[model samples]
Target: MKSNPSTDPPAEFLARMSALLPAAEFAAFLAAFDRPARVGLRVNTLKISVPDFISIAPFSLAPLGDWEPAGFLVTDDSRPGRHPYHDAGLYYLQEPSAMVAAALLAAAPGERVLDLAAAPGGKATHLLSRMAGPLPDAPLSALRRGLSSGGLLVANDVHGGRARLLADNLARWGAVNALVTQAEPAHLAASFGPVFDRVLIDAPCSGEGMLRRGEPVEWSAAIVAACARRQRGILAHAPQLARPGGRLLYSTCTFAPEENEAVIAAFLAGAPDFTVIEPARHAAFERGRPDWSAAPPAIADQLARAVRLWPHRFPGEGHFMALLGRDGEPGDEATRVAPFRRVPPSGEQWRLWRDFAEASLTVALPEERIHAHNDRLYLLPAAAVAVERLRIVRYGLLLGEMRPGRFQPAPDLALALRAGDATAALDLWPDDPQLAAYMSGAELLQAGADGWVLVAVAGFGLGWAKRAAGRLKNHYPRGWRRG
Candidate 1:
């Protein structure tokens, strides 16, 4: 597929839009497709504040809105993805409109949060950034020193490949109290019950929104219908995962009402506990079209609370979002779900990890939350539950593994730690020649005392290197090496 896409949209798609929109409005909507899409760089508050990032950013950036303090639009072609700051877990280059849903979910710090269908980790990263800290003296634990300290995020993608990718992105975000799992939505609902305080389902849909972005997706009316069916099936598991009085946000990056309001209407028909909550109005946000969904007057009236962002109406690609609020608060004894059965860190792997942390890290992890999954040792969030039957791609933070008598750290640990959190580190400027060499899997010649060294770009942790024989041998993952 060509990285640069053609400006013209599919003929059938244009025809559908003409029928859906008013004549004058349709003309403007069509014109939007011919224009460029707005790219977004959501700041990682877990790593740096928006003001701080702006002060140091090399790329041109403009704030999207005050509604989202961390959200910004990239104003120029300053390929940030290749920058050293990116490797430092600074920001995520997400689509502008796509950034809205997570903010709408308003996942506060110290809440038990879940990002269903989380992949490429965009929304999951946002939720975790806001979720870093204690889920209180409860099940969730996003523990850190000062940044809201306790809460936990459970991000799941059913596909194994996408789940792995999700794990990588969240790790790079320095998420400590999050779990990345590969499982069906129903399986998660069954395993955890309604334990989460906030649940976000960014459903897969027909790529009508990507028409302007030039995403290589073949769209058709049949596909829209298929997507709507799948969306409804997925939403069936939503209510079961959300705690009473908790919030659930359903979103899709599509212009189709079938996948937006219609799917929401269908979900409401089956689940009576949820009520659509109107979000705080923004000038760019338009109410959903009830008639478009062919829903009844009463149901349609509630669906009107849903919001739509058109490329023509908003400074972004198209998107649809609906926030549903579950009815009561969390005090039902029957609804309580079991937490991840704690297997206190033991055996050779546990001993090796303890040795490494004692020598390397300035802080100690919670022993009760440490889970030894097979040969690897994972530091799970406090809210994590046992999933012996489920397929887990990444279980919390993989501190490292034990090989015979020695412990080797994972790159995930480096990213999750601060430069100051480690006993020793190699801090370098973004433009340092050694930065390129480290990324290229080249060893750095350094004369220093070191066991496990945290490599930092500027002041943030990037990856790792080990100092031995008067030199820092590169321990950067081979797959991430770039020339």
Candidate 2:
């Protein structure tokens, strides 16, 4: 069941943990790796409701824990990752413990949120869903209204490749009110000062949780020390992005006390304006050990307010989360730093995009906020903040390319829409042969008028196809095609 057989605990790691854990708890923690790691998935509530997804679930799925509302545990050997439902963005395969971070942050509607280290966007997607508030009904007309409620998520990662993957994941989640950015923490702080309502730092740390992945991780005191140093450095610039009374959450997958308590302790010591807020408690959650570090006497007790998810106790990989609140009440919106943004011209840019939307979509596009970068057109979120010179992977909903006299829609534009939004959609069951054909980049014969068509799997947008002369040509991205 494990990816590698070298998951046996390192002697030094065992020795260190033996000193840290009590006899019975240490035995359980050691035994947890011997069992197969359970697979977990969080439903994309933006696309489908949890109950509806549960009614049609293809596998043995159960609630993950009390930790996350949308989180579920997959008890079967079924590879949901390889299924069409996953491709259609019904649920995301995530470690159950990883879901605990955003749950603790608890972003609300209309909040300007930031994920300081978002990549492949697990937590960022969760944040966007939470910020979406409540949905209206099943065949979602409120999806646009939910996304447009002055809410926007700034999901950033330092790596360019990871940033692109993150954008792709958010797109599949049908997240239209998000901006994907590739920039370091310091640069972000400088560009947008004291603006975000909620900020999360899922800081890079020593991979003690790699044990759950069945990967043999070389553990040492030096490795934990290096990770702690990097965490402290990145966290130093985080407070500048938080507005007064805003919440900033710090989390790590490592069990290292140095990475967890020591980093937060150090940040609090340097910055007097922030204090730890006791996280919402769960039965599986354990209190953080402030005694594990040389924390100041004043905040040492408050550090216990942080939560720890140990594999011996929680039903997933190890993770640590601590929430902090900035001093003073929430301030006015004008205090935010605006990025350099220009109005896209009305002449050539409008023609192709308008033509595509008018012909294909049943709903109206937000034309006022649509901006262009070269030939590419993007729909910006309401009240968006512009970044002058950062490497932004995505501005908003990438409407697609406006080339010559025609417009080519992005894969994202299709995913962001419901089957009802499309003028023509081919809704097929999961076992349909044409569904596999479409995902594999093969064309199909269909009864339809010639133009753009949304190929759907069980009423969910899978990708786009163009129909001409009763034949459907696959427009699904070649890179995304399944073998």
Candidate 3:
């Protein structure tokens, strides 16, 4: 058979895959590689509803079935990431298959959750949105209360740069209760032993799924073996982070059985305290092939409960998922951190922020929640974990920094604020020329009083501006400025 020239999966790889999948199914899988890759975006319920987003969305979208309620398949050629809605944190552009892990983790409204390998924060943000419930309608105070009292989320990445990226994404998602940490898996496991109610490990894997992006996949045996070994090490440390009876979700974008079924089989054998849970059934989701697993019949039977999303069967690249439950009574909760002493802002710092908030914000943020570190001010969630040992990128929502006597709101604070939350807002239409100018960091004339102003598009806050002498000085971060 002539392999697809565009998306070259190694011929040897294809031959190996052929033995794993049935003859007809294997042919369909190859044909799927020739078709254009499908694109999807998941609505950020922390900011807007799926229905509300659909009403205002410029692109045409199709529902993504019952499995992913907030997910939509974009049929239009609109670049969603370039839109103002994206700047406002309304949605996330993610692959359809990548959305499954968090949904299957099924985190509840008040549970401590951890994304052990979180970076670039797709699953971490999704987990937070699920835990916080729907947004806009859910009052900010209630959201804060739920996050602090119910539980908090900790997103960790091994790489420092990616950990910063994860913090940025969570900040945009308005996850005030989230902690972004950079640490080795074993060290984190030691510090937070059996503390999380739910843990997700989207382990690093060989890029077999990269074929969907028209990227050539190197499926050599050596690469597959290396990925499997790394995945096993990650899995070894991940379960220790989940409390007794808590759930652990393992996922990867590769189709290799060594990285998928075999890893799970080995983990199950070593950790008899954990048992496999059947994946949520979906028409597009197929069960793991026990025949592909080299484990004994009993272990393979348990592995069959794992789910596989094949490109041929679904509108996404291939993925593998296994859900496991730690065995024990469900009451093994971790010790909650006592409330930390919040250092009040200095007299001048307090005056500047107070005057700004009173003038520009309609909502009253609690004084107790505000914490001052150096010249920067942070709005902490209801609770915070100890960060003495971890490389913490962001502790909570950064309200902004104080410059001399002046107070400046951060871009993160701007995205986190709702239109209604701000008293002095410059609301712009999606197509309004001023919106582009604002995003581009161009100064503009304003009729409002001289002070800080919220720049908004379609009632969603985009960033900040300072009005003086009838001119609005753009306060949009230079790093985020559009060319």
Candidate 4:
């Protein structure tokens, strides 16, 4: 493979890659390298069903040929990045090939699932859309129902900074049921042994499939072999993290057989109880090449079940996937693990906030949902276990409604609450002249004394506020205030 003169190729990268595969295979990899850099995303089911999303989207929605429900061959567009819908979380921007990995996991609502290496929230949000069900037809009715029960999607990232992005994305999408966690794979597996109904290991790989985006990678047998070793450790321990009878979907964006079929074959050999299910029956996903028998004769048959997504063949990035199912039940008679404690605020403190909240905002904070954590009060859902045992990455996880009695909608709720008759909201932004003045840490003027005003920037709602005395107190958090 010639190193293109335009790119500053890494040392021996081309030479190394050529030694690992035939010239024809190297050419195919190069041809897939021509497309643009960004990945695509489809709207989730919970926010909008596939059929409905297609009806509204200004693109021709077709079967990604290899992917299932809602997956599509999105026409390349520069607008999604700038569109309001994208900002409103109407759709997710994801790698077209990456979509296949999540769909293959086949998780559903009311089921417990874990995204072992979730960060920047691509797969986790896709899974969240599945749990939130669909919006109702009766305008305000569906809006209210959507918030009533945001299902659980425990999105975790090992790094602390990335977990914040994961939480931010989930919140931006209004999938409030999602809880963020920062933990190692081993710790998570130990805490919730065999409890996850579905687990997605979009495992870290050699980035062979990402050459186009990251610049051409110099592939070599030794590098591929090393990646295979790392893949094996994660794959071997992945089953222990899944509930007995649960599903584990392993995927990577690279084309190394060492990291793809060989890793699965090695694990299955040692763990006899798990079986490789046919991908065709589940989602009619495209299958990997069946010609590797001559090279890896021992695992030739098992390789037939693995799925591959090549950039040349599919509309997205290149990827490899295999679905494995565990045998036996998930075990019996297990007690719930109490990981979080909800200590209520003191009576005097609660009364002060409660009275202030009742008089100032349109969204009512219920006593049951309101709990003190790390010295801060948050209104969360009853089933939000992801909060327990995990550091509070983002609070106000569950969005509430503006019940009468001095309540107002949150900025996110404003878009959601817009479906119903909401009182006029104040247009403000982080740097709004009014906001800047208010942030001088002083209250600004309100037109009326004790009335509701939507706190906004431009036209987007941030939260709510009230007018008292001659000052407009910023209801936005002191912690959340612009530093």
Candidate 5:
């Protein structure tokens, strides 16, 4: 039975939306939207085991109805802000509906992938975690070859600040196989034409799904029309960047058809060889609404292939996704420039930093990967090369170690790692007292056995350090540290 329109919406919002969609349908949607869904998050497998993470979390971690095992429905509660696990990087705060796009792009280990707008690093981290463990030696070799030569993910964000934030998230998740680039869609397409195996186009859109978050958009015809134009602009070049037979997962957080089905229709109409992959592969997936489907030659069947998550139907923000792939394209087998450069370290500075780190922490770091750049010695992935040509915003520093002959990581590397580098330091766990001190601007002496203790807010790895006897000095930059 059709629901009554007036029964569902606030009198004011209904008045505005009445002219937009069918009054009855708009009312039903508002009725659903009013009761915003609970928060959800995906556990980072690269950091901690799911069971171990849940056990340590202060809040209840319920399994999500539709997402994978690592995904959970994080209940909306007063404790979200105060929770120590959050500070520790135990999990990423993401909506359940948003997980669909990333989970869809979970390629086999070593597949060359791209996250076109991978800022704030949520989906990028998820993809890397899936690529771990033993893989076909050839693909694994290709993947590592790319990592050594810097051929893995090119996580690009146009914004400078957000790009740094993305790097931090990826590093904390212990990613060591990615390259961070800052460029626009057109720029990327021109540089690496049709080379990626998988591409995630989580495009920007009007904040329709964020109505509960106080998005200030008015439900007007002009607003929707404008957003539709923008969505088309963002997705127009997506196919150009995707290799033939490769997957392009397009997604948006907004519920508007202009940004969802309409955008997909436009892309399909322009790109002839691409066909949409069905979402039916997922056990609980639901097809997109038919009434919103576009005209012929517009991939109408593909609309059915798309997945939709209405706020009322799912415990998350509204989202839509379509996985499209091109047929009959030759496989990618391109080689890349080597990623390593035999740059020597400044012996005196290297020794000074090493001495400080060894006496302060418990873990041991390899010395070969440590080198000097711009007179500042940095501990980087041994494979990283020729970063000077690119405008490098941040390359993580390798601080000293705990015991003599052993090295530890510095906490600040969270703000400075590429995806494929093996920057994971053993012995650091979220909630270690040293981590809290680091977050609060304190430099700490190693106090644990073997002098190895994890420094983190939750369970995420920030960096490693050595134990010392002097009063701990705070390294937290005044601008970045929160009280």
Candidate 6:
């Protein structure tokens, strides 16, 4: 006799899920676990339009419908992640369900935004692009101009390593108005103090929704409970960083009610200033089950406004989201930019950078935005405030570093620059051997001026090159070199 498929999951988890979902729906959900996982990507609107990407894209893509305008379901074996377009920050490979939270946040241009647990930068990048409006049609000279003139995005992660990765992705995506930080929630709450127009907590969860990814997780009641407790703690500090009348978006990839509805219910009880708002719903999205929470009917009914994405009903993995609006008038607190202390370069130091910028850059970088910390130089956003206490990995756009005498451009500066921003550049096609050589950290035979040159692929900046004698010396970061 064949074994029962229902028993594939731990009996306790199955029982809990059965109690939460309708009998037929629970069975369908279980069957969905056996099906192949869906592959999806969100077009980086900062670089290419949805229609333009579709026209030039090598793979076949089916629209993910109105739920997400930029999201698409991959229908072919083409590895877009490995493509040169990815290096150019043309798109981001993300789970279809995970894309819902940022869209629900509905971040408008010029709003102060924060991705509390942002790492690997899927949602953070999405938020950045949304704030910047449509960059595909914008001129190259206007590329640095993002959504709001004073709007800023602070992407934070607790882990240092992930924080670095977050900075890398945002840099590639050309988020000029972003700041990357690694800090605890309590610390952020203390420093920011209810200042953000929108705060997103894609909270840490028990990975219940990612089972189809082929990773084995030892699911137990204790693990689920622990995750719920941690999520509540994170949510507790979220409101402190959100301005009154601003919005806070809470999301998780777990199916456990403890981590989803229960946490939200508890938060609603404690934070009277914040109220749950109904997210834009679709037929594919199910309302949060009030009965599943331990709260009273009145409170539980409020939780119903939250949205849930089930793998069985939708072509994506499980996800839960609740958008909460803080009550009050829009105050100056929401618009106050951080007061970042400037570290101006000395006369000698300024000369080196000025010479390089004059020679290589077509656009002039404002002196106020440029700062020098020791040997490294950075270009902060115009609205950047002081973050003296936070563990910031990257304060702003890293312009480059000062060596013994000459100024060396950072890879981040190259990636952040538009095609028209660089006066001297070596443009190569994706298939060009020289492109491979530059990416692999090999010397390029291309001759140019005896100074810095932007190495570009398909009009998108890849990295930097220093030309001297007769050839271009590859300046791509060794850590990012393609093997």
Best by TM-score: 2
Q: Estimate candidate 2's alpha-carbon lDDT, on a 0 to 1 scale.
A: 0.84
lDDT of 6 at 171: 84
Candidate 1 structure quality by residue, lDDT tens digits, 1-483: 123335467778888889998999998887776677777899887767667789889999988887777888899988999998888788998988888898789887668888999998999998887766222332211125322366678899999899999999988887877888888998998777787889999999997888887667888999999999999999999877888889999999898988999899999988889999999988798998898977888789999899899998888888999999999988673245567776665666667888898888876787766777667787877666566467878778887877778888888888877777789889898889988999999989887786888898876778889899769989999988887
Error of 2 at 360 (Å): 0.8
Candidate 3 per-residue lDDT, tens place, 1-483, comes to 346576677777778788887888888988887788888899988777777888899999987779889988999888888988887788988889999999899998778788988999999989988887655555452224333444578899999999999988887787777778899888888777777889999999987876667776666879999999999999998667888878999999988899999999999889989888997798888898778878987788888899999888888889999999998755524655445456789889999899878888876777877889888888776656555467777767788899876788887887777777787889999899999999899998889788888888887778899989989999998988899
Off by over 4 Å in 4: 1-26, 37-39, 48-77, 139-151, 214-226, 281-285, 289-299, 333-340, 352-367, 386-483
How do the residues 1-483 of candidate 6 rate in per-residue lDDT, one tens digit apiece? 123454355678768888877888888888886787898899988766788778778788998889788999999888888887788787899899999989999887778898999998999999987887765455452235642345679999999999999999988887778889999999998878888889999999987888655567678899999999999999999778999899999999988989999999999899888888988777687898787889877678889999999998888898999999999977777665557888998888799999999999987778877888888888876667767578988877888888888888888888766677898888888888888888889998766568888888777788888889868888888988899
Can you list the residue pairs that collide in candidate 3?
none
Tell me the spans in candidate 5 whose CA falls farther than 4 Å from its real position. Answer: 1-27, 76-78, 133-151, 217-220, 281-284, 329-409, 412-438, 442-470, 476-482
Q: Which should have the higher TM-score, number 5 or number 6?
A: 6
Backbone clashes per model, in order?
14, 1, 0, 13, 40, 7
Candidate 6 segments whose C-alpha is farther than 4 A from its true place? 1-11, 141-143, 336-338
What is the lDDT of every predicted structure here?
Answer: 0.82, 0.84, 0.82, 0.62, 0.61, 0.84
Per-residue lDDT tens digits for candidate 5, residues 31-128, read 66556457777875555567766777767778875446788876646455445455445567776777777777766565667788898888887776
Cα deviation at 240, candidate 3, in Å, is: 2.0
Model 5 scores a TM of: 0.76
lDDT of 2 by residue, 1-483 (tens): 223345676668778888989988888888787777879899987777788889999999889766677899998889999999898888889888989888999999888899999998999989987888766574572236444566879999999899999999988888778899999898998888778889999998888876666776777889999999999999998777888889999999988899999899999999899999987787788999988989878889879999999887888899889999999876665254575385684577788777888888887876777888888888888757878568889888787887678898888888877788889989888999989898899999898788899888888888899999999989999988999
TM-score of 2: 0.96
Residues forming the 10-long window of minimal summed lDDT in candidate 5: 137-146
Write down the RMSD of candidate 1 (Cα, Å): 3.5
